[model samples]
Target chain A: DTAVSQTPKYLVTQMGNDKSIKCEQNLGHDTMYWYKQDSKKFLKIMFSYNNKELIINETVPNRFSPKSPDKAHLNLHINSLELGDSAVYFCASSQVGKRQYFGPGTRLTVT
Target chain B: TQLLEQSPQFLSIQEGENLTVYCNSSSVFSSLQWYRQEPGEGPVLLVTVVTGGEVKKLKRLTFQFGDARKDSSLHITAAQPGDTGLYLCAGGDSGGGADGLTFGKGTHLIIQP
Candidate 1:
């Protein structure tokens, strides 16, 4: 079984459109995070949620919103997508003071 | 943001060779972690070092945390072709409201047979 899972492995959309990527973890972890990996392969933290509480906003734009309905799910919704947003978005989970486990990643392409 | 800098962004070596990758930072980290990622996948945790001047080994791979807790190194001995991947190092906790682990740009290692 996959410890961490993400929906829509690939996404392609036009600029100004809105999209959402969903993430789920079966590892029973209390913390989940969203990260963006640019073409240069730099993984930047975007948002983090622990037990459905928003933490670690990373100064992300208002257009980028993350919602965690529960400890096991975290979803990222992007409004007015820009071409610069084209990159791989990853979801990761970890227990307190533990190593993170990542999902397969959602590749987003904005035209 | 705490920044982690990784040296030699890219490296290619033949099988049986040994190499070391460095990850440095200005701010001290409560803990440090190393991960390996392949194309079309997310990073896989290799190890985590929490103490200064700590060293941990996994088979032929050895990880070391700097005495200052601001840097780390990964050394692989007798690298095999299967070891080819993007290696990333992250520092600090991924917890606390609005604070996340700072990651290095990553080193792309290519091992050839």
Candidate 2:
């Protein structure tokens, strides 16, 4: 079984539209995170949630929001998507003091 | 934000060649991790070093954490085609909070047969 899985591996939308990407983990991890990888292959942390509590919110745009209904799920919702947001978004989870396990990533394209 | 900078953003070598990748940072970290990602797949953890001046070995791969806890290195011996992928180093500060890791820009390694 996949440890971390993300839905809609690819998404294409127009600017000013809203979209959501779903993530689920079967590893029973208590912490989940969202990351964005730009074309230059720079991976940056966006948000982190531990046991459904917000732990870290980086300097991401206000249009980006993360919701974790439970410990196993964390979803990212982007409003008024901009062309600059075109990149690969990855979801990851980890047990306390452990290495993170990442999802396959969702490739988002904004026109 | 904590930043991890990786050297030699891109590397291309023939099979059987040896290479070493470095990850450096200004701030100290409580732990450091190395990951390898193939195409269309998530990153796979190669190892984690938690102590200063620590060295860990996995087969032909050697990982070392700097004495200051602000840097790490990954050395691959006799690389093969299978070793071609993106190598990323991430650092975590346990005292900071339970936040996610900070990753380097990543080194794209290409091992040609």
Which pairs clash in model 2? Answer: none
Against the correct fold, how does model 1 do in TM-score? 0.95
Residue A82 in candidate 1 has what lDDT? Answer: 97
Q: Kindly report which residue stretches of model 1 are placed more than 4 angstroms away from their true locations once superposed.
A: B94-98
What is the per-residue lDDT of model 2 for residues B7-113, given as tens digits with 9 covering 90 to 100? 98999999999999999999999999999988777888999999999999999999999999999999999999999999999998677456888899999999999
**Model 2: what TM-score?**
0.97
For every model in order, what is the number of clashing pairs?
Answer: 2, 0
TM-score of chain A of each: 0.95, 0.96
Interface RMSD of each: 2.6, 1.7
Model 2, native contacts kept: 0.76
lDDT of 2 by residue, A16-109 (tens): 9999999999999888889998988788889888855786564799999998877889999999999999999999998866778999999999
Q: Alpha-carbon error at B97 in model 1, in Å?
A: 7.4
